[model samples]
Target: MALRMKVTYLDGREEVVTILPPIFMAAEKHFKRDGGLSERNKVASTYYMTWQALQKFGREENDFDAFLELIEEIEDAEDEAEDPTGPAPQPDESSS
Candidate 1:
């Protein structure tokens, strides 16, 4: 089954993206195994990754390559917020 994500963009626009639940679960597992994310942050990270993956896949085929980039950006941002030493990675303009 697929999960849906309500995405709110910086431009004040909102949309829903559908993602396969297994993919989201895998991302969550990865975050937990990495040990870089807190308990709460790990959940949020999976959600963010799922949303980005859905958004990337929903768009044009060209966007597939940018999905990972967007995921990295979201993770980095979360890291920065939790730790000052961590700088937020910027999202790929091509995907955004």
Candidate 2:
């Protein structure tokens, strides 16, 4: 399955970025030299994937640190794509 995620920027723009093999290969190089992709390194995998997606998709080509600063949120495009709960229930206004 494609590793898809919704990337939201600080400027309020949101995009659905797909992580392809090129992105994974790059991450593999980086992590192999730094830390292997063990379960503990899941965050590293996620961030690298997001960064590469942003760059590869022409969304933002900044270096990783700069790209990190631009991201406001990261959500799974697959799981939340069909949120069964729907929107979070609003607080009851008549309670008090």
Candidate 3:
């Protein structure tokens, strides 16, 4: 599935930006490469990596501030997807 964000340009034009699953997966590896660094550095590195990755999908470099919102949305969705408690509980068959 693709995740998309709507950007409203300064000139009153609105456009939808999308990131496909492949790009997201590839970008994650680059983002994680700085895992050994301090939190501050990691945040900066992650933003840079995200910027670079999105650029490949046609996002403008000058619009990084808008991309920041998309990045946060993607990360939040990822966190929710990886959440263990998010799945439905299975039936217990212990008494069978």
lDDT winner among the candidates?
2
lDDT of 1 by residue, 1-96 (tens): 555555444445444455566566666575775664367676556555555565566642324344434332222232122233667788889976
Give candidate 3 misplaced runs (Cα > 4 Å): 34-54, 57-96
| lDDT tens digits, residue span 42-94, model 2 | 77688878888878878877998887898887777875463557699889999
What C-alpha lDDT do the candidate models reach, one value each? 0.51, 0.79, 0.51
* Per-residue lDDT over 1-96 for candidate 3, one digit per residue giving the tens place of the 0 to 100 score: 665444444455444445466655655565566553256564554454445545775655656676555432323233223234567888899977
Give the Å error, residue 70, model 2.
1.2
Q: Top TM-score: which candidate number?
A: 2
Q: Arrange candidates by TM-score, highest first: which order? A: 2, 1, 3
Q: Once superposed on the true structure, which residue ranges of model 2 sit more than 4 Å away at CA?
A: 79-96
Worst 10 residues of 2 by lDDT: 77-86
Clashing pairs for predicted structure model 1, backbone only: none
Error of 3 at 84 (Å): 39
